[model samples]
Target chain A: MATHLILRKILDTGFVSEPPPAADPALRTREQDLQEEILKVFGQALTVRHVDAGSCNGCELEIHALQGAHYNIEGIGVKFAASPRHADVLLVTGPVSRNLEVALKRTYEATPEPKWVVAVGECGCNGGLFGESYASCGRVANVIPVDVEVPGCPPTPVALLQGILAAVSR
Target chain B: MRIGDNEWPLEQRPGCTPVWRGRVPAERLPALAHDVRGCGGQLTALWGSDDRHLGGGFAIHVAFGIPQGTAWVSSDLGAEAPAYPDLSAVFPQADRMQRAAFDLLGIVASGAVDARRWLRHGAWPEDAWPLRRDFDAATRFEPTLDAYPFIQVEGDGVHEIPVGPIHAGTIEPGHFRFSVIGDRILKLEERLGYTHKGIEKRFEGMTAEEGARLAGRVSGDSHVAFAWACCMALESAAGSPPPARAQWLRALFLERERVANHLGDLGYLGNDVAFGIGFMQFWRLKEEWLRLNARLFGHRYLFDRVVPGGVACDLPAGAQAALTDQCDVVAMHVRQLKEIYDEHAGIQDRFVATGIVKPELAARLGLTGLAGRASGQAVDARVDAPCPPYDQVKVAIVTHDHGDVAARAEVRFGEVFESLRLIQELVRRMPAGPLLAELPTAAAGAEGLGRVEGWRGEVLVALRMGADGRLERVHAHDPSWQNWPVMEPGVLGNIVPDFPLINKSFNLSYSGQDL
Candidate 1:
């Protein structure tokens, strides 16, 4: 009965995933040939490690949305790794608060070479509403090198996928 | 004096609800807190404010959840020696709130048991109070390494496991120290404050309108709740209640936010147990739900939708039918999922009896929100103290006495249905009126408070108007503060591997509490 119900629900919500949105090639940060070489190594099997430096968790919610059925990002060979060492891309959100600055830096260093960092949300892009402060380190770039900055209070899931693609785009 | 017995005097503040606001002498701080708690009133929120510039010492404020309504109490202390009697003795949850206030405002809760720092994790110097009037918002000091001393448990076969300020997922940062033998956990101590961004200091001197935007972002998950509460305080102080249409729409949006969060949590809870189908179906439903939000409110999370005096957006023509349809779809899907979850022994085994927070422990530790309800403390702020639309809606409180993963799941399922019914009821009965109300310019020194039953729990925002009608002190409290501490107690005796499942069941907010 459980299996029957599960299968029934699956059929009821059939083919909900639509064609993925295209990322702007102009949003590319790495050099074309170098990016191509790196792409050859990673292919479509990209690994992501999300770091919430000091987010309100708004941007993190969008990122989670990207993993849902409508935007089945994992179907496209992108998997969220549990550790930075297994990750090829670091998807960071929020203005880097001073408390987590060292931790963020260490995570960036822990990722093996040829890593790309995608700064997410308005905070990660340019500190959002919480600009430089006594406790905030401002944007992600203030602490680490950022390859792509997706600016929105929290960019949509489609926009997040685009940001991730742009990090590796030539 | 028992508040439920009407012994203590509390004056009604201007605005919605029976929220009473008044100031008492420093000597009466502990007495008031004791009386409030004595009469079934739990401390809703506690924070201290710097008041030296106003020719008074630092002031401490505490909101209590009495049977009648929320009571916003304040105590003023002298600047020469700013110390209020410690509240930790009466209400243990005040330990962290007091520590955080001290970290930001230099106000001390004299003789509190745990005097350690709460929200200051080597971000700034000890003496540089961020919320003080003289402190510059942009002041930067060279960072120092924090050596936080975690309490130790020494016995034969006992070992320690340290978790995160950065975890293995798309979650917020907080440290967890576990002392256990093998897998069976003995004690779990959580050290959060890594996400503190000086939000209180950031709200200094902003126009009440601008403060609404900052409050909305205090915890993104509770934007509608936080923003509405902030605006409530603003509207309350300005002596302006929003139009009827605006209040109903706010209720509609608030319910929608509840459904959105519950959907995500339901999916994530399933995924934690490696139940792939649960993650797939629920999140898909959640995505469709969010698309509706974006279509109606122009933002997926409805950020900035709840502005001062009223909501920023109004439902377009024929939007009600679509909302009704979406609710039907979600309700249908959740019913199907719940049935499947009910019979699955493997999933049930992992969920049931895991991470138990007893009813006795829950009340003593001040467990709150959905998790609190699951633990058998049936204190829904909506039902307990109805303000405007909630008075009309008559929210049905869903609770479970088990206080385990399964029980929390039951509460989530029950709440989703209740919230759906609320959405339909809110729209079906929404009165016709202006969508926005112009807030009268508040006078300097005027104060107000707003309380909303957010999806997670009560979102209480209090503000005092500064000179030139700017907000002098704005404190936005998330239920996460009260709930996070309870999570530590919940994890006791659970195995190391079962930690993730147990933690997700509670699903407390790190960023919300850190601020």
Candidate 2:
């Protein structure tokens, strides 16, 4: 009965298509050339390592949304790596806290060179609500150099995917 | 009334929770705690305040939850001494609270077993206390980089493993030191405060309305709960309550928050156990739920939805119908997924008997919320101390006696179903009225307390008005403070590999606790 139910459900919800390719008129030619160059240099795949430098976890939730069936980031050439050494880009979230400042710097240094750092969420971009304080050091740029900044309280999955593409293309 | 032969006069405050405020002699503080315990009181929270400007010297406040209401016991330690007898011997949880009090406000809890720094991680000098009036928030100090002395375990084949403050996944920072042998954990110690953002110190100059925004950000996932609690406290202080429609909307948001969190957790739990299909399915469902939230509420996580006097947004026309339809669809899909998850052999093998927290142990640790319910500690604020809309509707408290990973998962499933039902009822019967209420200016020095049962557990906020209607003090207590310590015992006997599964089952908030 269980197997039959699973089979029936799968058949009913058959063939969820992969997300359509990125199409922005402003960056169409540039992105296409960048995608080709990236494929030639690092193959068609890019591995990312995510770090949370004292966020409210809102941004992390949106980051997790990138892996949902609708986004299906894995269907493309992007995958989340378990360590910085294996990563081609680092996705950092939240306003960098004073306590995690050293850790963030160390994680950035540990990632292999020619790496990109994409700061996600408003907190990561400009320290959102929790700006500079005795306990917090401020935005991601305050501690480490960030390549791409995705600004939102918690950016949408589509925004996150675009940010990822922007980081990889860079 | 007399508490253990001590005649301490008490004054009752009318707010969300039944609060009795009284003063006791500094020496009798431990005795008062003991008496309260003997009277079946649980130590809810202990906080310290510097009232030198008010000529009240330093003050320590302890909240105890009894069957009738919450009793707030206060003792003023003169500025000369600034010390009180510790209550850690009576309530083990008070040990950390006392240390934190000392670290921040310089109020010494004399006789505390562990006097080591709790929150003051050498960010400032040894004598500098941030909470004191004289201390400045802009002061910068070079990192001391002093090593924390963790207690060592000495035995054959016993080794220590230190993990994180930085983890492999996109999780918050918190260090865990485990004493283990052959992959079996003998002892586990947690070092948090890595995410402390000076939230309490920053609340000094903000008004109650401004402080609500900070409260909501204390833990992003439980924004509605924290914001509602803050609003309750502020409204009570201002002698203004939101309209009936506003209360119903708050409940709706709270229920939606509950469902969203449970959906994500269920999926994460599946992924932890290597069940990719379950992860994908549950996450897909969660995405749909979030999309519905955005369509209805205009924000995915419902941020800034609940303000001081009422909710920020109202349900648009025909939105209720759309919500009802989505709820029906989610319920059907969730039911099917539950069947598949239950029948799956691998999930059961990983979930069934792992991470057991006995009921007695759970009660002793003062565990509450979803994890507490999983372990048979059925203390739901909606049922025990109902507020507004919850008072009108009946809530079924879900529990399991097994106290394992499977039990926690089942409790989450059951809660999601309940939340869906509550959402339907709340949306269908929402009263039509003004959404916002005009809040009167709070009297200077007026104090209020707010308590809301968030999806995680009870969220308590204590507010005091300063001159010009500014906030004097705002302390937001998350349930994670009580639940984090219990997580150590939950994972003691389990192998190291299963730690992630057990940890996720509890899923305590590091930022909430650190704040």
Candidate 3:
């Protein structure tokens, strides 16, 4: 009787995900007329390798929220890769700590060509609070090239999705 | 239990929690530690601070959990070569803390085992100590990497698998080296501190009030508890007490944070085993709960919500009904989902007996908070030494003796229900008053300590005031410090693939502990 409850619970609570919101035009920093062709290249698929350089795990929590039923990124053909070698996009968080500086660079180099790097959170965009200090490099762009920067103490799940989409459209 | 032999009197600070402190000679700590442990005391936190500028030398501080409350004992060492007796023999958890103190302040624990650099991973020069009175916080050191020597295991079929500073999951950075034979792990060692962002060094720039924000970010997931601990310490130091109304709301926010983290962890534990229904239902419940946080307060994670004196914001209108209804809704869904998790054999197969930390090992290693509770080491700050509103509310202590992944999950489930009941009580009993209080002007040469049972474990913030009304030192200790070392013993007999499931069960914080 109890074993059947697992199957019954799934049937009772049907799919809870909604269609993700459309990408904001203001966040689309590029000219629309110039980038219509690039959208077709990787529009339906993107594999991300997330690097936590030194975040407090705020941005990480928001990114984890994307996998939930509310904003299911997997349903829309996006998945987080277990290895950087299998990834098409590198999603990095936190102001890069000095200890993980070389590790971040090596992980960036490990990714194959034609990969875009998106920096997530206020720390990633501008080194939020723990700015350049003895133990912190401060900001993702300071260490490696960043294609997109999502700025919030930690950007919301919707904002992260928009940032990732903006990177692909570029 | 009292700390010292009365050469120096212990001064009890004015705070909700009972914290007694005293300073002693460096030679007196070992005997004091032995006395505390003899009365069933546990090590709370250990750190070192530079005192050369004050005409004294360097000072090493240790806090221990005693029968009455927490006993904070400090000893002064001379400026030339500051070294204190090692307590790792008495408290195994003191090893890394001692190493971290040496790395930051250049104070040596006379005879510590495994004294490799803990937090200073070659990012700063060997001679450069960030916590010293003279070290400049603004100077940018050229980034350098260093090699860490992992102890090797030799046998007929022994091989090594080095895991990460980065992992497959969306977690913080920490490396794990596992030596295995035929998929059964013989031994595991973890090299952490990749998330050290000069947080303690950064605190020197802020006043006690501004230090609130930095404390909250020490471990993002435990923001409410950490900020509250800092505020409590600052309030006690400045001779100001938060209003009773503010205390109630702070407790509510704390329970909400606990609920949020437990929800996320339970959801991911199911995800680790590919249980689709459990992950969806639990996360859906969590999304609604976090949405309520953003709607009620201004932030989803409750960052900066708990301020220096009391709180940054008040409970909004309709909060009582909204929160009570959320408690009802979440309780219903969690009850339904937990039933599924309990009955599903696949989930149980991965959970039960996967990774075990026996009770005897837990006490000796100083495992604390929820993980400690699951392992039968019954220690919860809310129950043991209740602070402010927690003392007002009846917090039922929860525990299990199995010391496995299944027991940890069961504890989370039990705590969620208990927390929901508390949230209901809190909303209905909500009082009307001021949301935030003005902190007194910061004073120089004053010190204070704040301890809270954060979601992950015991969160302690030790603050000292500096010259010009700025913070001299802030050591935010996470329970992960005590718990992370035990994972080495936790995964001893477990297979490699089961590591993720076991780790998620404990769900300790990397950023929190690394700081």
In the range A84-160, model 1's lDDT, one tens digit per residue, is 99999999999999999999999999999899999999999889888899989999999998888888888988888
Clashes of 1: 0
Best by lDDT: 1
Give the alpha carbon lDDT tens digit for every residue of B1-515 in model 3. 34443333577877778899888888878888887777788998999998888899999999888767788888989998899999999999999999999999889999888789989888898878988968888788776658888999999999999999888778889999999998999999999999999898888859776798888888888989999999888887777888888899899999999999999989999988988667777888899999999999989998888888888788778988999999998898899888878878888999988899999999888888998999998899888889877777889988999899999999999999999999999888877788767877667877788888888888888888877768878888888989899999999989999998888888888888787
Q: Per-residue alpha-carbon lDDT of model 2 for B212-323, expressed as tens digits?
A: 9889989888999999999998988997889999999999999989998899999999999998766777888888889888988899989888998998899988899988
Number of backbone-clashing residue pairs for each candidate, in the order shown: 0, 0, 0
What's candidate 2's DockQ score?
Answer: 0.64
Docking class of 1: high
TM-score-sorted candidate list, best first: 1, 3, 2
**lDDT of each model, Cα atoms only?**
0.88, 0.84, 0.87
| Model 1 agreement with the true structure over B1-515: per-residue lDDT tens digits | 23743466668876887788777887887878777777877888999888888887888999988888888888888786588889888888888999998888888889888989889878798888898888999999988779888999999999999999899988999999999999999999999999889888888889877899999999999999999999888998899999988899888888999999998998998999989889888888888888888998898899998888888888987899999988998899899899989977788999999999999989998888899999999998789888789988889999999999999999999999999999988888989889898888999988888889898988999999998889899999999989888888788888999999998888888888888
RMSD in angstroms, all models?
1.4, 2.7, 1.8
**Model 1 C-alpha RMSD to native:** 1.4
Worst 10 residues of 3 chain B by lDDT: B1-10
Q: Mind sharing the TM-score for model 2?
A: 0.95
Q: DockQ of every model listed?
A: 0.89, 0.64, 0.81
